[model samples]
Target: MRREIKYSDNYLIKQLPKATAYVNRDLSVAHISDSWLNNFNFSSKNVKKNNILKAFPTLTTKWKQDIDYAFLGFKNTTKTDKYFDSNIDECWLEWTILPWFDEEENVIGSIIQVADVTENFLLKQKLEKLEILIAVKSEIAKIGSWEYNAVNDKLHWSDMTKIIHEVADNFVSTIENALNFYKPGKNQRRITEYLDQSLKNGATWNDKFQIITAKGKEIWVIATGKPLFEDEKFIGIIGTIQDITEDVLAQQKIKESENLLRTLINHLPLNVFVKDLDSKKILVNQSECDYLNLTSEEIIGKNDFDLYDDETAQIIRGEDLKILNTLEPILGKETIITLKDGQKNNFLTSKIPLFNEDNDVVCLMGFSMDITPIKQKEEQLKLLINISAIQNKKLLNFAHIVSHNLRSHTANFSMLLGFLIKEADEEEREKLLEMLIDASDNLLETIDNLNEVLEINTNPVQEKKNIHANTEIGAVLKSLKLLIKNKRTHITNQITEDIYIKGVPTYVNNILTSIISNAIQFGQDISENKIEISANKIKGYTIITIKDNGIGINLEKNKDKIFGMYNTFHELEKTRGVSLYISKHQIEAMNGKFIINSKVGKGTTFKIYFNEND
Candidate 1:
């Protein structure tokens, strides 16, 4: 057995409280501390030369390699203190072997030191895990820390902190030096105030400010600071800094974009607005106020109820709430209250919900356009469609009636001629034959008139043809020379000779003839009648005026029925009513229109609109 010695007897061994066993090259336990026996359950007897493998069979090969290296005069050292079985609480001990020599200078057995470094190994593992955690959190937060020790007057910065400051390697730092990096004025004063508060009141602060870097770059930063402590004694202020320049600049750009959008909307032709649901305040464009004939201040910040009846106000509020709840847009025709005089007007409105930063519906933005003219046109179209349908049915029935009557008359004439041809006596036969011939001629004339009426009804009333207005007017005047001479009607054409209109030439001539002949026929009881023709071009159409000193229409009683077929205002048998009806249809088919302006006992004016050949 080796002599037992106190662990404290060797200063080197005593310093290693966790060191255990020392084995030699011969596989003998030369040194074993009390810690080794208690830790591994092994003593000198259990760790003899021949029994070394038997005692710790798990460490046989590793121990033999150490002995062989020691015998070769090579130092064998190892470090391993790993937990093999966490459930069993089993750990390992590492070894170092060194050869010992006698006075003859020949190596014998080597000395081996075994150490138990489990606690320190575990502590090192924990520190590595902490470093990994810090790195991960710093990246996620975009934050970094720094501190200046006032007592030692030394500065320290974390890796992430230096990266945030955009500082160069040559830069030197101290408490005063760091504070000086803040931009002058507001930023510097804010940082000074926070530092003072931290020192005087042990306070913590969070602020955003601008800083100038060593590279002469201005950056926006958010910083937080709190007083640091060691053993209940204040040392200095420790804090974190984050680069927020991109975020700040992005916010500024958003504000500018919003301002530009507002300018565009205010100047648009349509009215636009946003309304806060909670406050009921309207954010409207300048056009909205102008459209309502009111000032912005008068219409803003007031609910619809203030400017409208209870029913209308409730309806608008309901619609707004519906949009808010569904977060969908409202589109269609609507009526809105005007701020001026509180009149209700129609609008084509579309409204959508506007969400706040959190994606919650906060208000509604709406666009509107005036559709009053369209509404009126829609009503007029409804009436016209009804009239057209009625006219179609009546025209069909009238054709059938005319055809049946004409066919009956022709059949009677044919039967009379056949009977006359069969007469026996010469005188009687001659008289009967003459009567049959006369009847046949009369039937032929009636059929010709009927066929002409049918042709007028079924022909394509208009075609696209450029007509020289002045040339057509001259031709009509030449045809009406006899009437003009007998009536002594003085006519004046105050129109440019080069004026032309896009229309059917025949229809244009027919319309001009009808108007001119009517003026001649319905002239006032005067020695001489006067007619004036004039033209004015507006937009894409020409307005032709035919003013006549004739007995005017009694518009109060005859306005609505003036264009109806077979309608006659004059009490004259010659008024067949076909000419005016044909004229109206022909003019309409050419995409032109006619209107009469007249008063009883006053001269009449017929205004015709024709495409100005633009």
Candidate 2:
């Protein structure tokens, strides 16, 4: 027989590790474990023979009723019972109530076993909350889990997975049916390969592809699987499936948009380029590469300095930096560029700063249009306009001369002849004849001047040669040496030997002679009369300036008619305005300009602009 050992109920109860107590039918505490006293913060001497409910004042009527059921020969237990001690601290308790029997086998009281299970109960509650949270997150993300058991040929889908497949809750799915959900052809074939690989070699797979749900709706899904193994034996595969239809479609649209933009940029006729903050080229369209006579590979990542001369590069880089700093756009700025082939071109360029989502300038975008053809056309139009203006002025001058000068001369001749006819005395008749003769000579001179003006207006200068400015001035001065000496004028020719201009030599000489002659003729009667000639180059023009200290007219009064034919401001009888008018027309015909500056009692300065020699 097994060694029989017996111990008193109190001894066994006291020896128990759990918080235990034995109570009588009257709900009195008969025995209490050391753990019970320690758990309840009660001393053994204070609660050994006391009523259970009285000892544990926190025990409510519900506890008494449970004990009553045990007294009636019923066994009752509470897995989680809430209790609060005198300190108002909450805990979870487990209580077991069983009927106790005496030697007669009749029920006496109940044996109550109590345990403080707050830690385990709280941990179980936390696990339940976590499961609920995970379920909520999975539903929101359109993600679901799945498992396949190879041995049993069984498949399991989470509720979310079923929902993603657009199936009812009661629907059943096998591995084959689940594979069928993938769209036919490439998607299905790819998924089948992944599954077979995982099953054979215990591999893992992650793929995003299209699928057809049970509702016959086509959608995109990202599926992932990892082979499951137990003791080196391949059991099955567990994986996740996500409904990524919206995300995939959005990505496709974005890709299409990018491609469309690229195509449009490449096909555009305008040069387009993008630069980073460092002023390095990051992007360039086909037109930009063509404009620079470079390939995209050569141009990309390069700054202006790498492709252009130092001066040109500095200018371009400066503009880019300004745009970047100011976040302002430069629009329709006309620029001229000289290419490698010695060809010059014009462009209308615009640059704008590109911004990020934060509204800060991150880079810059530029557009340049080849405006060379347009610029050429504009130059031609300007030439035509100048020609038209010259022609119009010439016509107006001719009409005025005919209407006023010619008519005046004819009227004078008619008057003089009528006077001669009316006169009877031989002396008077002879005087009238002399007057008519003088009038005829005047008429001849006027006609000659008019013809000269008309010739200069109608003939456009075609052949022009480079004439040294100093040499031409010397020639004019030599021709006017006698006139200058007679006037006691001091003349200075400051034109350098290297200064040259493009014009007909004869016209250049004539223009200088006219201006110098006027200086000599209009000077005050003084031995100190002075005239100075100087020439210099400015931009594309050679400017010849003639300054003279002479009896200048009041330009405020005579400016409009200063160059008019036969309009003289001085009282000198030999002063004819034809010289200056002819000089002005000659200069214009040679594509030159004449400017005059004068003040009464001061001096006159004449500036003639001629195209500088190549």
Candidate 3:
């Protein structure tokens, strides 16, 4: 549109508000509005071909910088808009200049528009002052403020707000910047959605969320905001930012403490459970789950009736109800439960009522300890006490026998010696002296036997060491080789070389020697007398067997008394029955055990059991 630009025909431009003008590239005035003439008190001659700096000399270097930037071709288009006072005084006008161009893309002139925004500018300045005041107050109170302008796509956060967010001093605030400050995962998503929703529905919100600072420090902040509205149209939002990091962390610590308490309850070894007052389901620990043989999901919502039979359930429910109703703590109550395996186990339980905020019982918390082992130990102790009483009784009988037998021999010897001292015949005196010598030998033998028993009892118990049964057996056989040769007895060793047993060497050797010697002496009349020793491992225990093709006891007549002291099956001249008794006791003391299997004509098999190496 090639049209002539004229200043005389534009009457409205003369009266138009603000300083309006048209200037050529050379700063020659093409036209001037009456508002500009009035503000600057200028005529056509003064403004025409005038330097822009000369017109606004008070602008200092700012005006010169704008002229240089526009004239040096550094930029094809330029706008220098700033607030300045007019000659009328106290009147601020924002002068905006736009460089104009011709059709051939030549810079010909410029359009200058000036607006009197003094009132709007002052109001904004007041608002900025209020914002700064709020920031100062909030900083002192540990609070900050933010505003989002959706229409302008701008964000404004107070200085204190930026500081609270742990951002740099020069950081430009934006919604993206705010969102980036929040920690990832739930907190970020939640806050982003909350802001979006609040903007959409114009809803007010006050929320706390977690964030990571620029220093990678975790912080908690409380954000409170309301929707921004202009003429009932939603614009964006404005809000306060608070650094509630310390308070939030303290609350988290309390929550963690509560969780830790619950974790402790779950991990307790005892069978722990809690029953809800209104609900039939009971929460139970892992121990309780295993006891019931039910999965956590299976038994979590069911009552006693679902887990047990009617009768059993009633028994439990009644007691639980009593504890709940009475609000009394019941502890260490013994109860018997029949397990799914058809085995009964005893439990020591404690039941207490759990109260709600109103002090009303809302649940029953129960703890049960499996006391089966304790009960078994009590029974074992009672049996051991009886056994100890019997042992004492036997010791008393032993003492009486020793006293009576020794006393009789001593009295007879003393009487005979007294007679011998007065005897006149030498033959009679010699007979009395021989009798005293024999009595002395008997007393010595008795004392020796007593000493052996005492030594066995006084020996300190020690842990069984791994010893080769073959080596010990061989040593025993070697010691008794002379006896074997004299009797022409054959010995057979069939024990596995690698099958060792844990035992004391002395006790094990004594047992082997005693049994083997007995067998050899009893087998004197057998045409082909043989003693066999064998060992094998069974059921985590080592089993050793010694069988002899010698005289066997009539089990029908002497089964119970075969291993008893002084109770001999056959009248073998050296039958003390002490060997078998001592061997049995010794084997048991070492944690190994013994059993004798015999038949009247068939021979006896002595089996020894030793536990395997741990």
Instruction: Choose the strongest candidate by TM-score.
Output: 2
RMSD to the native, candidate 2? 7.2
- Distance from true location, Cα of 350 in model 2, Å: 12
Runs off by more than 4 Å, candidate 1: 1-19, 22-25, 28-78, 81-83, 86-123, 129-142, 163-165, 262-331, 334-345, 351-366, 370-614
Task: Superpose all Cα atoms of candidate 3 onto the true structure and report the RMSD in Å to 1 decimal.
Answer: 21.8
Tens digits of per-residue lDDT for model 1 on 1-614? 22334555444553455644455545666555655556666654666544444544556677777778777888776746443432456666576767765556567566656666667777777999998998888877667888867679777877777777777655667778788889999999999999998888889999999999867899899998888888978888788898888889999999999999988998897888888984265788888888756788988887777656777778778889888888889987577555435566678888889888999988888888888777789989998998788568657755764676578777877787787778778898788778777777756755664564556557765457777888888999999999898778999999898788678787788889988887777778789999999988888787789999787899889987676545678775467455565677667666678889997767799988986552
Residue-level error in angstroms, candidate 2, position 399 = 3.8
- What Cα-based lDDT does every candidate model obtain? 0.75, 0.85, 0.76
Per-residue lDDT over 1-614 for candidate 2, one digit per residue giving the tens place of the 0 to 100 score: 11222467568878899888777666666677888888879888778666677754566676778888888898885646778776887887788878877766678777788887889989989999999998998988899999999899999999999999999999888998999999999999999999988988887999998989889999999999999889999888899999999899899999999999989999999999999988899999999888888999999999877777666778888998888877789999998766545466788999999889998899999999999999889999999998799688779878988789889998999998888888999999998989888889988999898888888877767688998777777788888889888889998888778888798887888888898899888888776899898888888888999999898888889988988888899999688789988888888777688888998788899899986542
- What TM-score would you give candidate 3 relative to the actual structure? 0.46
TM-score for all predictions?
0.46, 0.70, 0.46
So what's the TM-score on candidate 1? 0.46
| Better TM-score candidate (2, 3) | 2
Query: Residue by residue across 169-284, what tens digits does model 3's lDDT show?
Result: 88898888788888999989988888878978877878888888888888888888788788999888889888888787798899999789768977888998888874365777
Under the 3 Å rule for N, CA and C atoms, how many clashes does model 1 have?
A: 0
